[model samples]
Target: MIQVDRLTKRYGSFKAVDGITFSVGRGEIVGLLGPNGAGKTTTMRVLTTFLGPTSGRATLAGHDVLDEPLEVRRRVGYLPENVPLYLEMRVREYLLYRAKLKDVPRSRRRAAIHEVITRCRLGDVEDRILGHLSKGFRQRVGLAEAMVHDPDILILDEPTAGLDPIQIREVRALIRELGDRHTILLSTHIMSEVEAVCGRVIIIAKGKIAVDDRLDRLRSESSIVLEARGPADAIRRGLESVPGVEHVVQAKVEGDYAAFEIHTKNGSDLREELAQRVLQNGWPLRQLDIRRTTLEDRFIQAVTRETISAEAEREAV
Candidate 1:
């Protein structure tokens, strides 16, 4: 479990993280998404006790990140975007060393190292030097190091970064399996990874949280795609008149048929009303379906909307 309330971090006048608030429940795998320099790493650093927040408060499993940083660190395992690893050390040796550093008893260190090795799929290369390992294998080694202490929370930043497709899949599967037991907060630029592995997503932009909601619910919050063989203006007017329809943005028209996306209130389904209207008007309905929203769609919408809002605020000021 993790909670951050109005957390703010600044470097002089530049605010890296600005009054962001969110929580991760037990055993939940939440994706933290943002464009470059959006303060994702800054937020994670503050949460992990790697950096103290300039203001606000955060806690890990009820321990204050600032006041009880040692306790928080004990419970949180962090794999930063650029993973810090000892290149000269062997995989097993590196994990073993990290386990000891985390205060794993000498009696348990060996077993803990082995467990993470197997879980991270680093068994074959366990004895190989980390410097000699491939980037994918090295990434796994970094993960193994992170979990060597069996922390309750895992904070992984770009866990699959710079990996091949197959390696990315491997890391994703590993993250999913870990989520069954540990609370995971991962930051990634990859939308498919969030859709595939995360239950909820927190889209951060301009040092603020743009959207936070369940993946399935967000996907359902998409426009209704309608294609009908009728006059474009007439179709648009009919759709706009339908209750629950907010705006009907036109897509394109070919001959007598025109495609339009009907934005509805809270992803409401207006297909029945739309069908009735088309039938009453004797309009030929070619296709009517809800357009599924992807993670990319949500991310772009949030960032773009936030940018516009910020611009308007500046103009008002």
Candidate 2:
């Protein structure tokens, strides 16, 4: 439902986004991830029609972002990182106003506003002034306004930015519920948010695309965790000589138990073999479990690799 092709955005001599391309399919939730100054917001702005790309193209639901901006806007619901809201207005009143601005038919405006209020769980605060609401409520109000028009695609940037743990969980749950019906392109610096909600991840670094793949595949690329109740050196020696184990890094030695993060070749599962070795040696086994790679790991690896490659290119030039 969303497509970006070699898109680039520049401000004077600086390139905020450089030749990045990706797409979001119908009913898919994709996360756009990056550190600060990593061009994530730039790319989202170009897609939302707030900024034009210096060169290249982007389309939302078959309408060219540059040529059919109005049409694109009609199909897209964007909630920026800092949601712009009229604080003095009541929640319901503001949503009604946004519905009108989005060109929701006057005849159906009431229904549209009601639907979003319900979807965003704003029933209790619908009549409360936005300024008096908590930060979490205000965030929900912003979300309600964004989807008041029931657009085809939802582009949310940092949807759970400043909320406490409870509020963050609430917002993440709502986003997941929305994903069932909307083609969502989520952008955030929170790795856990992406891990919790996004099916695919796109990591951008230094104005370029770094990694784009399914979340499951990325996690499978991480190392395994193995711990045993034996001498640290003995455990390390046994694991090191294992057929599939490529590298072993000692983690800790607590009492009789020793822990190591085992990097195996081709993402192998060697739990059974490791346990059998421990049993053969008559060493007590404490814990032999997989510590699945997290989204944070994949993100760090991507950004670090990109930085290294960029430095190498600059040196060669």
Candidate 3:
């Protein structure tokens, strides 16, 4: 229910988001991941109508973010990294106030506030002051405020930023539950969170879209790890000769045994062939396994590739 095409946001001469385009279908939970200052927050702000794009276009639920900002706001609920809250107000009181501000009808405001309080697990602390609540509870209060109006889309930036492990798990579970009803675009530094709750991942680097793919498909990419004893050069040559083997790089050596990571073409598994080659060469095989690619691996690879490309462009100039 969100569409962004060639979106760019700039401050003076610095571009925070540069010509990036992507979309999130209805009820889809997509993770927006990147390193610090990589434009993740900038992109969310633009989508939420808190900041306008310098160029390009974005629409939420068929409403243009620039031309129809009020309509876009009505459909989007935003929970920024540092949630704006009234610490003096009680939890339920704060949510009630937010509902009114979001234009919840006077008749329905009470019901909306109550529903979000229950969903966000603020039943016990609904009467407690926001400032008196713990970090975790305060976060829940922020989430309740965002949902007070029952928006169709939720744009959350660092929903689990400062919470402890238990609180993080709680927030992750809540986000997963919310995905069933709302189209969510989440930004966070935690890879495991994305792996846990997000079906798809869009990784940004250097103000550009680096990788966008399904989590299962990205994890399907794999490589082989081999460790054996005999002659390092011979083992390397034998592995390089195997069909589908893309590159063989020596990982480390411990006495006579050496470890080599075998990168393969098309995510191929060559453990059996590598093992047979080791047996034919009279090498004592110690380890043979397939190492599946992880979200973190893909993230680092994409960011590294972007950095390398930027360096090359500078060098060419």
The residue pairs found clashing in candidate 1 are none
Model-by-model lDDT, in order?
0.90, 0.90, 0.92
- Kindly indicate the candidate among 1 and 2 with the higher TM-score: 1
Best by lDDT: 3
Give the least accurate 10-residue stretch of model 2, judged by summed lDDT.
219-228
Tens digits of per-residue lDDT for model 3, 1-317: 99999999999988899999999999999999999998999999999998999999999999999999999999889999988888999988888778888999999988898899899999999999888889999888888888888999999999999999999999999999999899999998789989989999999998999999999999999888899997788889999999999999999988999899999999887789889999998999999998998999999999999989878977998
- Model 2, position 241, has a per-residue lDDT of 86
The superposed Cα distance between candidate 1 and the true structure at residue 300, in angstroms, equals 0.9
Per-residue error at 15 for model 1, in Å?
2.0
RMSD to truth, every model: 2.4, 4.2, 2.3
Q: Measured by TM-score, how close is model 2 to the native structure?
A: 0.83
> How much lDDT does candidate 2 score?
0.90
- Greater-lDDT candidate between 2 and 3: 3
